[model samples]
Target: EADIYQTPRYLVIGTGKKITLECSQTMGHDKMYWYQQDPGMELHLIHYSYGVNSTEKGDLSSESTVSRIRTEHFPLTLESARPSHTSQYLCASTGETQYFGPGTRLLVL
Candidate 1:
């Protein structure tokens, strides 16, 4: 099983603040994904990468961007956060099976 971890489990920030949600996995998984979800809403894939240095935006349009500099690291960055960006950000890495991090809940004031 991949040990995925997300930092700042909960965040509360004022609008227009730039934030980066950190996601890391202990296991070396080539496929990684980032998803966004509002309370009680279904998860929407925002970004994904096939491997290090390969990234692609997901179906849902988002203001944030993601980069995979290393096989075990895929971080999502929001240049300027807004209230509408408030939601839970989930990170997952897939081997034979997909494993997810605890997720980061963000609130922009």
Candidate 2:
């Protein structure tokens, strides 16, 4: 199994609510990333960090925020969740290439 894990693999929230999706890895990889993808859709990079405290927001994650205070944990938050935010969030980390998390599917009504 992949060392990466995501909480509340599925979520449903009212519009304008707030939520945080957690991602953690036991692989000890310092490089972490977040991607937004819909079911059966192409994954788009949203946020990434080269190492702890080195986060960068990608083009697709303009509305989201990420912080990297620890090497094994990278959490992404949406302050005001909307229907447009409904999608799958995937977390990845590097070893030889990259390892992916199970993915969190969110739905906003």
Off-target runs (Cα >4 Å) in candidate 1 are none
Q: For candidate 1, list the clashing residue pairs, or say none.
A: none
lDDT (CA) per prediction = 0.94, 0.92
Give the number of the best model, judged by lDDT: 1
Residue 100, candidate 1: C-alpha displacement in angstroms: 0.5
Worst 10 residues of 1 by lDDT: 1-10
State the weakest 10-residue window (summed lDDT) of model 2: 55-64
Assess candidate 1 and give its TM-score to the true structure.
0.97
Per-residue lDDT tens digits for candidate 2, residues 4-78, read 999979999999998999999999898999999988889999999999889998877459899999999999999
For candidate 1, the per-residue lDDT at 85 reads 96
Error of 2 at 4 (Å): 0.4
lDDT per residue, candidate 1, 1-109, as tens digits? 4599999899999998999999999888899999998989999999999998999999899999999988989999999999999999999999999899999999999
